[model samples]
Target: MSYPDLLSFAAGLLVTGALSGVLAGLLGIGGGGIIVPALALALAAMGYGGDVGQHVAVATSLAIIIPIGLSSARAHDAKGALDRPTFRLWAPVIFVATLAGGISAGLFPGKVLQAVLGFMAFFIAANILLPFLERLMRRVHGSATAQRLCAAVIGYLCALMGTGGGALSVPTLAAFGLPIHTAVGTGAALGVPIALAGTLGFLISGWNAEGLPPLSLGYINLPALVLIGGVASLTAPFGARLAHRLPARTLKKVFAVFLVVVGVSMLWAAFG
Candidate 1:
């Protein structure tokens, strides 16, 4: 990249990191919903291949989620909100699913990936915007088999979309009778395995692919990954602190609007 291009990329990452941190804390989201598309736009604009760019963004976003998920999970755990038993039961299947999803991501075309992410984003936003729809979502229960199935599905889907598990996990957990706080905490914790397994899969899948940018390790962009992950992790605590004082509902509504924009934009990029 040229000096100017590098500057632009850094600036974009800075903004993305800052916003992701605040949203993670303020909304109980893992922030991948915000990060993935933002990275996709930046990479594409920097002249990465149309398809490769989005895939890299997705993989890199998943990689970056490691820190944010860990931090958020720790905070929630400290608050006694994370459901450990649920996480324990769900982890193994999620590991397998994320691995499979990561591998499968390479088989699909860019358009397919974008369509998948766009639809997932739309669903996420809808759940937030329309409480009734969220309420209508199926709820699981104390059954180990049900939790395992839910985790496997969430892990697979999130891997494909480059999201942390929060978007899917929280609602599913809530449906299973976990409190919102507990669900969010559990979701954050679950993201660790999902991200790790998916990251490894993407790394292997993208290793020999053509048209990757400089400093890329497979699908992961090292510069962006390091900068965004570091910055977002640093800022998450501040966001958590702010959450104690700020109006969560207002923040979440704002996030929902942003999510809608992301979904619509990705769909346009994919099909338009």
Candidate 2:
């Protein structure tokens, strides 16, 4: 990239990172729902091919989530809210499934990945916007084996979508009869394994792919990761503080609208 283009890219990353961090903190959701689609669009604008750009975007989002996930987990742990037994039961399967999903992601068509991201976003949005949908979502609370299976599915799908798994895991935990706070805390801890394993898998899978962007390590874009991660970490505390001052229901509605817009755009891009 030319110097001017490099400047533009860095600027975009900074903006994206700041927005992601704020939304994550304010909404108490993983940033990947925002990060993956934003980066994919930005990369496409920069002339990267659809499949390669989406792969890079997903991988980079996972990489960026590592530190943030760790920090959130620590915060939740400090509050004594993390469900250790649940984590111990679910982490191993989640890690394995996420790793496998990340590795296999490169083999899928770009449009498929795009559609997955879009659908997941819409699903989350519906859960938030239409309270009735929550009543309809199947509640799976059975044997330990069944819970682990839920974790595995959450991990795999999160890897494919470049999420930290909180969006899916928290609700699953709730379905398992945990309180909302405990579910959120446990979900934060679970994100750690998903991000770490997903990053490693993507790195290995894309190590030899052709036409990667400059400053890339496999599918992960190093510059984007560093820029976004650093800025996000710095901005998140501010967002968290603001979250306490806002009406959470109002915030959820606004965020749900944003997700709907993003979801529609992604699906359009995929099939357009």
Candidate 3:
């Protein structure tokens, strides 16, 4: 790595760190959802080749989510917003499902994963853009069986897309009649195990994967994980502070738009 390349990589991580931190704080959305594509682009720009760069991005993002999810879950637990019953019920299912997800990821070309991310990004935008879609989501309410199925799907897909559970989980919980706050907090709690299991799966599956950058363990990039965690940790609180003053509707609209662009852009990078 030349000095300029090193500088570019570091700069890329910093930008990813800053934005992810703010979004994590400002929106209940997890940082990894945003980080996956950004880090993919960064890895490509750093001259990494083939699918390995995107694989590293996904794995590293999951690795980064572990601490963030744990901290968030603890904070929500302290507030009594976490629903213990739900956690006990769903966590195991998520773990098993995500382990499956991890295995499945290694079996495919990277474009498939890119498509998953794209679909999720669009799904998120639709849910937010007209919260009415939530009414349809409500139909699945009150079925323990349905929730278990939903949990499996959410866990698998979120892991595949390198997101914490909240993007889809919170809404699902709310549709089941949990209060939004409880949903958010519980979703945060769920993310800890999701990330942990997903991280482990990715680490094992991508071990010695072709074209991974130096110092990578499986798909996880240690430097990106370390640096992003360090910087993003510091900015989350600031984003939280700013969240109090921002108009909720406006902020969500802006975030939704950005997600759409990121999703399409990743797809373009992968397919185009």
Q: What local distance difference test score does each model get? A: 0.80, 0.79, 0.77
What local lDDT does model 1 show for residue 16? Answer: 95
Q: Give the per-residue lDDT of model 3 (tens digit) for 1-272.
A: 78998887888888888777666655555688778888888887778745777778888888887766765666556667689999888999998898788767888777777888887777877777777646876786667788898889998997678877777787677667776667767887787778888889898899857878888988899999988877776676555455445665665676578668867876786678
TM-scores across all candidates?
0.90, 0.88, 0.89
Cα RMSD of all models vs. native, in order, equals: 2.3, 2.5, 2.3
Error of 3 at 216 (Å): 1.1
Range of the 10 consecutive residues with the lowest summed lDDT in candidate 3: 236-245
Give the TM-score comparing model 2 with the true structure, all chains together. Answer: 0.88
**For candidate 2, lDDT tens digit of each residue in 1-272?**
68998798789889988887765554445578778888888888788867899999999999988866766666656666689999999999999999999999899878888898788778877876675434544444557988888888988898888988877776667667766566666776788899999999999999999888888999999988999888876665455555545564665576578668768977987898
Report the error of model 1 at residue 146, Å: 1.4
lDDT winner between 1 and 2, please give it: 1
Mark the 10 consecutive residues where model 2 has the least summed lDDT. 132-141
